[model samples]
Target: MSSRSILLTGASGFLGSVLLRRLSTLEGNSVVAAYRSGKDEGDCASGVLSLGPIDGNTDWSDAWARPVNLVIHAAARVHVMSESEGDPLAAFRKVNVDGTLNLARQAANAGVKRFIFISSIKVNGESTPLGKPYTADDTPAPLDPYGISKHEAEQGLLALAVATGMEVVIIRPVLIYGPGVKANMRSMMWWLCRGVPLPLGAIDNRRSLVAVDNLVDLILTCLEHPAAANQVFLAGDGEDVSTTGLLRRMGASLGHPARLLKVPSGLLQQVAGWAGKEAVAQRLLGTLQVDIEKNRRLLGWSPPVTLNQGLLSTARHFLESDQT
Candidate 1:
């Protein structure tokens, strides 16, 4: 294959950084990595372009000089529970919905061959019942502003594809964890390292998570595949783990004792609700799974790395980082 020009958004972020590194290694890819700040042209990617606050009015002529072969959109206004912004939905829609559609319009006008969008499983809702994991066929019922914007983006992109002849692929991934992971999962790692005994040993809630690398692999798989056009796929490590089981695995990787003790799930939930930590309680005691058979059947993809392998990599990074 000949060299193909690809434009990637959010190259400075968590998943974006990992995707940038992977795309840069491709033999015939002319990668144009877009970021908001912190890197000048050629600083990180050979063709790094600064995207100054994406919105409907954002210009793309300066970024894509030539028709792009592909575009991997990873940027979005991620929800921060303590966000300073007063209106969360407006904030999310400004970027995730409007800005994303703006990018799609530009890509379509520029004759981009394919556009791969990174979405979230939160679009399907917070959790699924035990033994009844969510699948792509489920109608989106987003509960949060972030998920709502992403679902809207998905709809907008699909419509844009129909109107402009641009192929679009949508990927919805659950909690993505790998080296340098942050947020709730990272907090668990921190507590484990500090020898904090968790009261979740007997908790049987199952959660599905994808390693960053695994999610990236799926993105790459969808980027060039004809079958991925106008398709929505879910991604996970294909390993369903209980809360206690996952913590134990991470503890093993960190060389620390999980120090897990049995606690009643109901009591845990009640205390957490009383303490204004209901979300945390639900995650620690709920089952959230995804059926990724579509990814396997259609894309012929499998998680290249095992869940334990991904967890160990994350643990190693935690140990090696300044946080330790």
Candidate 2:
């Protein structure tokens, strides 16, 4: 086996930053860390390049200079405020779809061996049922512009792969949580730290969340695994948790008791509607999970970090970061 050079975009993101650090430790591989802005302080990779903006016009020559063998595209337009947008889909397509395809095309042209795309579980619809979970083979039914763009990008990548013979691997991850996490996960941590009395104790919904370390492990597994070639995988920590269950676990990790009130899910929804938080209500009350057995069976991989361990690490980071 020859030494391979990898171009990793979004190296500054929460998951991407961790992925970059882990990839840097590979014995014989060269990892190029590309970020839109901000420096990666812990970066000890072969090269670190500043990508001004990851749009269609962005140049990949610097990243591909060393005969890049693999391209891990983790940067994407994940958040799109559709209501305030004039052309939300088009805006999303510019970065998620067009920009992604552009980068994949460049990778193919540069003789890159594999293109690994980090997508979202939104491509498999919003939520799952009580017993049923999402699978890789399920038909895509993206309900939002962000998901729609990702699904389109997946299609484009497949087409590009067929035309250029570049192996493409897509991994769709659900809510990823770990140290340096942001968005809803971060909000949850903040609320927990402050001892907010959340009324989610009665909400019995199972959601699948992946730890950053586990997700990075899966990404690394897909990089060189022959069985993962041209495959779509659902990334998860394998253990599902309910709202109250997760709160309890996270609270323990933060060394705080979970201050939760038992409120009916229906009443919560009604109150959320009155307070103009229907989306938040649905998310809090919904069950979103995926079946990762296929990823285990096919690639012989499993989440290395247990959910509680990961949560502990996340909580520690949050408390430490806040004090800094």
Superposition TM-score, candidate 1 onto the true structure: 0.97
Candidate 2 segments whose C-alpha is farther than 4 A from its true place: 37-42, 80-84
Per-candidate alpha-carbon RMSD to the true structure: 1.4, 1.7
- What is the C-alpha local distance difference test score of each model? 0.89, 0.88
- Pairs with backbone N, CA or C atoms under 3 Å apart (clashes), candidate 2: none
In model 2, what lDDT does residue 125 have? 92
Model 1, C-alpha of 136: deviation from truth (Å): 1.3
TM-score of candidate 2 against the unseen true structure: 0.95
